[model samples]
Target: MHICHVNLASGFSGGERQTLTLIKQQLAMGYQLTVVANPKSPFADEIRALEQCQLVLCKHYTRSHQRSITADCDVVHVHEGRAIYWALLQRLIHGVPYIVTRRIDNPLKRKWLSQLAYTRASTLVGLSSEIVRQITLRHPQANVATIPSSPVQYPVSNTDVDAIKAQFANKFLVIQAANMYAHKGFDVTIGAAKELEKHSPQVHICLLGDGKARAELEKQAQGLGNISFMGKQSAMGNWFAAADLLVHPSYSEGLGSVILEAMATGLPAVGTKAGGIPDIINHETNGYLIPSGDQGEITYAQISVNPLIPASTICSK
Candidate 1:
């Protein structure tokens, strides 16, 4: 079967990573694949690298709606919120069935366009129950599917892991990997790092990923010795292998894919009790979950990471 995947995100993050993972598996199953992406999206490069895959470049917003996108595909899979417009356009113009996977738990707008998009899709896939709840609460008649995103085992390089280990030597590295948005709780992580400085000096917080919020977040971290910002990284597998622990203190979240990625590397996480994090983190087992935006609780979770959970990971689950 031929599948057309649409992800019009400007930057590559958890959702984009999930899209690539799905495409990789489908390719192995001998399915024909076509990816519709932004011209400047970093995600496009990964699709181009895959053999037997067709890459279609489309501008963000309205321009993503093209006849060629859904012309020859069996089904259109929309990966991001903005791509919903493109999928609906194709369905309207070509009579193709489309599926939308909602990655964020943010409430759907009551506006006509959003209602129309949500209502018109053949299937609405939510990465977490919370995401599903949001849509069903709005468009009660919409067909929603509770399909959680799975984690991929990244190819780890010993050399890459060694380099990260060498840089943060002798320090208990607790990394938080995600796009630097205000709601991501970067500030809370920084605050926790500061609170740890007086007591657990060996514990360090490394904020990974980048975005427009980086500059301001960096300013907030100024003069803080226990925290450092590692801008947008490509080798996530390597960093996960080298880190001692992972923390995701988002004020809000969908499923917290970063926790799954870290778990794949046998690295346990201390994610806040928000969104779908509860789905991944089994308290005192693979990892721990604290109240969101609670600096004191965040610090406690980091300092109290079990020494034995590393032997088993949630990757299998």
Candidate 2:
């Protein structure tokens, strides 16, 4: 079987990483694979060296020119938002059916083209049940399936973990790993850190990721010593292994796979009820879920996560 994966993201992020993982697994399973991505994007660089996977550069989804590959494909899999129209066009012109994996819970525009593209797809997969619900709400006839993104469980040496722990010694590490985007709700973290600094001097918030919003978020955290932003780090597993808690207060989320990664490291999470965070977090059992963009709730949640406490009981609703 042949599978053509399309991911036209401008930069590398969680969704692109998931797409890359899927392509590698499918190729290993003896499925011929082709990937459509931005030539300059980090995702393209990662996929470029993969054996048996044909990397087709589609800088812009609309201007894509891959009719020959579409003709030979057994299945067309769209992995991002802009690629939906590209796959729809291929299905219309070449008669190749495509399935879309919608990675976001943001509602689709109520337009004819958006409706047509979704309804025409062979299947629409959501990273979580919440995303599935959002898809159905946009188009009731939309065929949707829920398949959560898998965690990588990145390998890390004990030395790296110990080093990270030593860097933040004597502090209850509250970590957040996500692109510093506005929708990621960095404001909530800043607010929570500001409040926590007043009472819980031992609690420290460490954000690990960088984006256009970094400067703005830094300004918001002005005069705060309890919070620190370390640009993007390659040693995610080391941080998770060292951290006491992971707080993801995203205003909008697809599946919150970072939460899953933290859990894989035996680190608990305090995520917002937004999007598919509720899918993985069991509310006081595994982790906690609070209102999206609630600064006070985040502050309270961080204070509750005692570093001395074992990984067994982490957070609550």
Candidate 3:
């Protein structure tokens, strides 16, 4: 089958990573794969690296649709919101079958229009059961499929892992690998770090990834010397391996891909008990989930800083 995937966002994030993983997996399985994206995007470069794949440079087609995109492929698998408009347009204009993957927790709040837009799609794939439930609750008759965004086949280099491990050797490092967003609770993670310092001076918090909320998060971390903002880095597997634990205190999440990535590296996870996290993270098994918002700080800090719990226990589950 000829499958084409499209997303407009430039930088690499969870959704972008998911797109790359799906495309690579499909290509390995002998499917004809092509990506419709910006030539300058990391997605474009990654897709082009695949010998079996083809890429079409259609940068600004996100807001509206073009007949050419849907005409050539048998199946159009769309990821991210920008591609959703294209998916619906294809169905209305070209009679092409398409599937969308909803990877984020907060579905747009505009109910009627959002419902209409989603119901019009051929099939909607939710990255977590909570997302599927939310969609069904909104449009009772809407068709939504549940599929966990599987862990990436993370490449681990021993040299890289050792280097990062040495950088934060003495500190009991707590890392949060999430985009810099309000919903991601980077502020909350920093708050927890500051609160933890009152009782435990040895604990340290590292915020990973970059986003619009960087300035605000940095401002919040100002007085908190234990909290360090590392910004965005392409190499994360080694950091995941080096960190004492991973904490995801999002107000909402589709599946918390970082949680699985941390678990795969034998690192424990501490996240808010919301969305798809419950489906994968067993309380006191691989990780701990706390209530959303302010209450999460206390719960997350305690779980993350605990010395009794070993990171190795996370991978076993």
lDDT of 3 by residue, 283-313 (tens): 8777787777764354444544567445542
- Tens-place lDDT per residue, model 2, 182-241, is 999889999988877776788888989999999999999989999999989877888988
TM-score (all chains, Cα) for each model: 0.91, 0.92, 0.88
Candidate 1: list runs displaced more than 4 Å: 60-69, 306-317
- Global Cα RMSD, each model: 4.6, 2.9, 4.3
Q: Where is the poorest 10-residue window by lDDT in model 2?
A: 308-317
Report lDDT (CA) for all predictions. Answer: 0.84, 0.86, 0.76
Worst 10 residues of 3 by lDDT: 308-317
Best by lDDT: 2
**Shift of residue 308 alpha carbon in model 3, Å:** 7.9
- The per-residue C-alpha lDDT of model 3 at residue 284 equals 76
lDDT of 1 by residue, 122-207 (tens): 99999888888988899788888888888966788999899989998888888988898988998888888787787677777788
Enumerate clash totals for all models, in the order shown. Answer: 0, 0, 0
Task: Tell me how candidate 3 scores on lDDT.
Answer: 0.76
